[model samples]
Target: MNNENSKLTISRIIQAPRSTVWKAWSEKEHFEKWWIPEPITCKVVKMDMTPGGGFETLMSENGEEFQPHVEGCFLEIVPLERIVFTTVLTEGWKPNDPWLSMTAIITMEDASSGTKYTAEALHKNPEDSNKHLEMGFEEGWGTTIDQLEKLIMKLA
Candidate 1:
């Protein structure tokens, strides 16, 4: 990958099957549970898991107020295998202005213990990529993934 278009990849092995993880990701109710860090509630406004479909969410510290956290479009979806989303476009392929446009590719693979999950955030430019890193992408993402693991484990 070129440095100009920086990409950050994070992966984990969850003690669950790909179907379980995919269910958590594909279902609105299940997704919101671990999509964000604790203390911050996540509301799934819209989720159409198909190419050119919409994916929107709101997050709020207090239940009273909710603000837009993610407004993106699904570029690709392979059941139980992979998902690709981008913030550059909204539902219906409408373009949107974002502080930093990026495409996120999430994949799931079978593992000896369970499932190997990976998330890759690809930025348009190095500056934006560095900005995400500076904004604690690793910590935030890792925490959310951990939360996901816990949820899956409990449900398992």
Candidate 2:
């Protein structure tokens, strides 16, 4: 694992195939099912799983008032391998002034009996990285990943 001054990495070995995990991310319905933690529902406003494509989503506690959770662009996409996205740009590569500019790299590799999933959230500065850490990045991401595993396992 590479450690950076402005980056956070979380990894786990999910007991599912790489393709299954990829499907959970690529499919809008599947993604929405586990993108957010329990009690918080996710609504995919727009999602294009391609480079420079939009990846927008909303989250709501009660299913009425959906608040913007992610408004970003896909930086890279490799089927069943990796996904990279950034909040510095919107769909079609349009620049956006975000409170904090960050890129997330999600990778999946074949494991002995499942898939090795990893996510690295990289920030432009240490302050922003620390802020995210303080904002429960680990707990939030961990819970989402756990939900993803459950969803995939059920589908499998």
Candidate 3:
């Protein structure tokens, strides 16, 4: 479900087990592999899966020179079920003005087909939501999810 007021959402039924999908997300090494749209690369700088813990990554096109991607903190973590993170704060609950501010909620659940993965990006206002949509949120997020499923399939 998506909210036109200030949220954009996407969900998919990943044809893999929840544990495996969670492993791909919880492990930084595995996370770095599919966190971004490929051809471009992602480098996981830090991922501490706890309340007030940091989650940061750098991205690059050439694989050498990297640029800042996401520098944020995890607001909540429910083991393999859900994770809430916000870009408005850094690790340890420190305030930071990000280029774009958003809090993301990611949920994974068991499904008959596989794992039901949902991602919701919550913005402070519709203007920000529009900005993200204009920036190709659907395609970008969808691609990464596809990459994730592909990575899991490959590794399996």
RMSD of 3: 1.9
Per-residue lDDT of candidate 1, residues 51-146 (tens digit):
999999999999769998999999999999999999999999999887668999999999999999999999987888999999989999999999
TM-score attained by model 1:
0.96
**Residues 1-156, model 3: lDDT tens digits:** 245679999999999888889899999989999999999999988899999999999999999999999999999998889989999999999998999999999999999999999999999899999999999999999999999999999766
- In model 2, residue pairs whose N, Cα or C atoms come closer than 3 Å (at least 3 residues apart or on different chains), thus clashing, are none
Give Cα distance to truth, residue 121, candidate 1, Å.
0.3
The C-alpha stretches of model 1 lying farther than 4 A from their native spots are 1-5
Model 2, 1-156: lDDT tens digits are 334889999999999999999999999999999999989999998889989999999999998999988899999999999999999999999998777689999999999989999999999888889999999999999999999999999988
Global Cα lDDT for candidate 3 = 0.94
Per-model TM against the reference: 0.96, 0.96, 0.96
Q: Could you tell me which 10 consecutive residues in candidate 3 have the lowest summed lDDT?
A: 1-10
Residue 91 lDDT (model 2): 99
Query: Which regions of candidate 3 fall more than 4 Å away from where they truly are?
Result: 1-4
